[model samples]
Target: MKVSLFITCLTDLYAPTVGMAVVKTLEHFGCQVDFPADQTCCGQPAFNNGYPEHARTLAQRMIEVFKKADYIVTPSGSCCAMIRDHYPHLFADDEVHQPEALEFVGRTYEFIEFLTKILKVDLTPYRLPEPVDFTYHYTCHLRGLEMTGDPCIGLLRQIGNCRFVPLEKAEQCCGFGGTFATKYPDISGAIVRDKVQCGNRTRAQVMIVNDGGCAMNIGGAGHRYGSTFAVRHAAEIIATALEGGKDNARR
Candidate 1:
């Protein structure tokens, strides 16, 4: 498939390796991936904060940037959910742009969802060096957009010797709602603190997350709170598993 990588701004900065891994994994599956240089934020930051004008402006920019792609994929589920789930409402008032916005929605997908749902990737070749206990967190946006199976777990299960350490509150929000954390520090901190406690209770060596924002939020708090767990992106963990656990060497 001809794929265009969204490369969310947060991932581009805080987690470039995840973006790189996404590329490598897709290429391994014979996808022709293209990164459009002109892409910018998916306008989710502004949209979530009730700034429709600013959000709409960036939405238009993004639409124009990836207009020709056969399928648009991004490592961050939050960004994909923003464009796929929210952009239509951003342009609903304008009849002219609504059609284009809807068109964009049809071709957008979250990274793991694309692999499992669209590509039907054969995971028989992927394997881990040894079995390791791990847990995954689903960001708010991902759970909101994805109504079915856990794509992250589905992909992770493909790797031999890796076992999922399930979290009882796996669906709980990690308190990283973009500006929500900044606007309400106390509430955000408390919620994420509980999340860390829960993950640490699982005794999982690493916590896997799909959204860049969630990785930063939960991962950052995990460090601050001294949780006995390392935070990693799904792409990173998957790429490592595919490489026979080379990512473990870095840890």
Candidate 2:
């Protein structure tokens, strides 16, 4: 499949390694991946900050930028949720742009969902270099996308040497609701503190977060709270598993 990577602003600016992992994982499955340099923010920050006009402008540009893409993928669930769950509403009154917005939503997918759903990927052959006990935090926006099931956990189970560490309150938000974190630092801090504690309780080696913003918030708080686990992106973990599997097969 021809896939266009929508490297979200947070991923592009803060976690470029996650972007590389997404690309590597996709290519390992025979995908033709390309990056659209003109792509910009999906206007999520502006929309969340209550500036509809500015958000609409950015959404319009995003629609135009990836007009030719066969499939659009991003590592950040929140950014994908902004496009799929909210973009149509942003252009609902505009008859001219609403259809395009829907089309944009149809093609866009969060990284893990695309792998498990659209690609129907089977990672049963893969194994981590060593067993890893890891927990996952489902980002809040993922529920908005109707991904109520544990697709990510299901995929993680396929890695032979990895253990799925069930996180307490996995569905709870990590307190990184874009500007919500900044606008209410105390509330955000408290929420993330609880989240990090939950992860700590799992006693896992790493916490896998699919959204860059959530990873940043939880990772930082985990450090401050002296968490026992490291925070990681799902793509990075999957990439590591696939690399190990490839090396083992070569041997």
Candidate 3:
């Protein structure tokens, strides 16, 4: 499969290792992964901040870059949802772009959903060096994209002795709604604080989030309070399982 990596702006800048892991994991499953160098932000931040024109400009660049990709995969559920669910509306009035927009969104898949549902690659060959307890935070767009069942957990189950702990209100947002967190700091801060608190309550050593924004938000808060739990991106965990096992998975 010719998989094109739509490494989100967050991953490109903040968590490039997760993006690298995604490539390694996909290649391990026999996929030919391509990293389109010119790809930029997926336009979700601008679009969510009520700047559709700016967002459309950003979207046009991505549309041009990955149109020929056999599969457009990204570690971001938020971006996947934006391109898949919102891009059509963003271009609804433009007859020239709408059809192609639909086609592009159809080809886009969030990394976890692509790995679990679309690719269905077997993971029996990978396992953790030690059993680790993990709790999943359901990021917003994964649910919006109908990426239900927290597919990452199912993927984790394939790893040897990885424990899945139940988190209270797993579907709740971590309060990092792009610029929403910046515009409404108090509300966002409180939401993320409560979310980290909830994850702490689960007593899971590792807190897993599908979206980088959520992981950063929740993980940041956890670190500030010196919470015992460690936060990680799903791609990092999966890549660790494939590469080094549990010891290397620790951040």
Candidate 4:
């Protein structure tokens, strides 16, 4: 299976480790992974901000980059969703890129969804040494995008000896809606505060979010308040499990 990595812009900058772990994890599963340097942002930020023209420009660039890959896997659900669900609309009137846009969307998959659903790779060989307990924050774009039917809970369950504590109102947004956080800092902070409080109430050492934007907001707030909890992306946890990391790894 040949897979192309669509390293989202946020991951490329803020969390490059996530991109590395994704490549390592896929290769561990016996799949050949390629990184297309030509790839850029998936255009979600611009598109969501109502900049269709700008979004289309980036989307077209991305489409051409991975046009020949058998599968295009991305670590970020929100970006994958934007490409899979929104790119078609963005290019609907573009006679040159419409078909290419559809082709790209047809092959895109979120990391966990691709791992568990399409690849169906057995995770029993992966092992985690510590029994880190965490409450997961299911970002809205992931749910709204329908990337995974289970919002990553099922995939986490497959890891050996990892404890997943359920967050009250786990489906609630962490209030980091890309530019939404910047535009409405107070409201975003209030929402993240509530999310951190919920994670703390669960008594979990860490909170895991699928999207980097949400993780940054929630994790940043936790850091500012000196909250006992830390934040991690699902990919990092899974990668750690694969490597048999420490017995008390939180993030």
lDDT of 3 at 221: 87
The digit string of per-residue lDDT tens for model 4 on 15-55 reads: 88988889988987878999988888888889999998998
Index of the highest-TM-score prediction: 2
Once superposed on the true structure, which residue ranges of model 4 sit more than 4 Å away at CA?
Answer: 147-151, 245-251
Q: Model 2, stretches more than 4 Å misplaced?
A: 246-251
Clashes by residue pair, model 2? none
For TM-score, candidate 1 versus 4, the one ahead is 1
Best by lDDT, which number?
A: 2
Q: Residue-wise lDDT of candidate 3 within 15-75, one digit each (tens)?
A: 8888998999899888999988999898888888789999999888899999789999999
Residue pairs with backbone atoms closer than 3 Å in model 3 (clashes): none
How would you encode candidate 2's per-residue C-alpha lDDT over 14-117 as one tens digit per residue?
A: 99999999999999999999999999899999998889899999999999999999999999999999999889899889998888889989999999999988
Estimated TM-score for each candidate: 0.94, 0.97, 0.94, 0.92
User: Model 1, residue 206: displacement in angstroms?
Assistant: 1.4
> Clashes in each model (backbone N, CA, C under 3 Å)?
0, 0, 0, 1
Stretches of candidate 1 off by over 4 Å are 245-251
In candidate 3 the C-alpha lDDT for residue 7 amounts to 92
Ranking by TM-score: 2, 3, 1, 4
